[model samples]
Target: MDIAFFTDRRNDLGESPVWDARRGWLWWVDIRLNRILAADALGVVQREWTYSQPVGSIGLAMGGKVLVAAFADHFALIADDGHAQPIVAPDIGEGAIRFNDGKADRQGRFLSGTMQHGGQAEALAGVWRLERGGSATRLETGMKLANSICFSPCGHWLYLSDTLEGVIRRYAYDPETGALGPREAFFDCNTIGAAPDGATVDSEGRLWAALVTRQQIGCISPEGELLRTIDLPVPFPACPAFGGADMATLYVTTIADSGHKLKSDHPDAGRMLAITGLGARGIAEAIYHT
Candidate 1:
């Protein structure tokens, strides 16, 4: 099957797209616009909420709330009622960082990363985990920009994208503690894009990555083999998630930037795409309770 259609919800720098199984909604974010986006199954915008500050990604909270990554504050819990609370704050010293693409492990812990918006690489920007009761712990560090992050089907490996570094690395992970071991290069997309943006694991344990700069989506095997490349009409295919009732629909979020001059070419640049017949169910992303 081919791409069904594209919807221009006009997302400004859309970053992450997640499928809320319980609510049957797609939760995503437009970082530059500082807004959270919710959409129905048909790719129609259901509701949009403005944030006090830019939010990178959102995690499902236990009490019908969401754990959000704040660019200025640390970690904030935004309730379904629209109230938000600060849960954790990072000491970046000079400049502030925004939480980027994040996902939960199979064990249900929230794991997210940070970007050094106006700082140095040694600033120790990396992924962190929010344990029960909102306890925070650092998982990895010394990365320029952290984007796509997901766990393997067996929970034995973690695929993390360093956009600036142009490498998507895989690390051995401890499923029980959510600890990441040493990292090894999985796939290097330097020839095409700056780096991989967001990725999701299929039920068969394969990874599908949104190749940001190249305007393509890559289907890679667990062994780091490039299986397929589907070109996108948009300039920046920011993030992709496998969702829909049967998890057969591949929902992708694209960014049409003034800097990239993409608007003149693909009018639907800042839109979402629903590519059906993926013929695969993805592993359920973990949810947070506290």
Candidate 2:
């Protein structure tokens, strides 16, 4: 119900956010800044690591000291001291194809999707799964702007969406086989005139989606009903995560000026934000087992 600024510095395009329960720190990425950052609970940026390629998204590792990251063209395990171990380079094709939103499933497999820079109609993007021993597999294809990826707490459902399609699809997940059953159109963001961006699941199994095109965060019930919408302070919210000691605080990342190729000077546009008093708690994010 209340949106508060969490950080002072602005992020050009902040994306995926994950909370590390072991360290009580929140980690996120500035997609265009080519960096991964971790902040303490008090909003102090503890670690800022920059790389040659963009850090598309990040996931917690089993020990909580190392992080699993989805780089622009590959996946890597980054240590607390900023050391990076290059993992397998997924076959995402060439030219403008790069990784985007990603999250680890309940089974400890890291799942990330790619986005084609200019091929919206071709649907050249896909979702890939990475196992503990560094094995990779392409699970699904035919996506445009891969976003809104998360799994239910019970590990039975996986949610995914392409920002350009305006539709979020839910897949029946089989953890043992690492296979996804046929997907069904779970919810249409077009109904709200907003495209869903990065999303997460609450302990109650509700999906909280960042409505990028609109200045709002939409919460949908597990049955695919839009339960309510929360007003956002900025126009382009990139993602949301549940953190804090109690997992009751909702943190959101945003896009500042030059976002979507547009320019604006809203003071709080690109800063990290926190929302509280919602009385909702979140399930612990699945860690990527090494």
For candidate 2, report its TM-score. 0.97
Leading candidate by TM-score: 2
- CA lDDT of each candidate? 0.77, 0.88
Please tell me which predicted candidate would have the highest lDDT against the true structure.
2
Model 2 C-alpha lDDT per residue in residues 130-242, reported as the tens digit of each score: 88889889988998779999999898899999988999999999988888899799999999898998999999999999998888888999999999999887778889999
Error of 2 at 242 (Å): 0.3
Pull out the clashing pairs in model 1.
none
Please identify model 2 stretches exceeding 4 Å from their true place: 63-65, 257-263
Question: 21-56, model 1: which lDDT tens digit per residue?
Answer: 887788888887888878888667776888777777
Give the runs in model 1 whose Cα sits over 4 Å from its true position. 66-72, 119-124, 191-194, 258-265
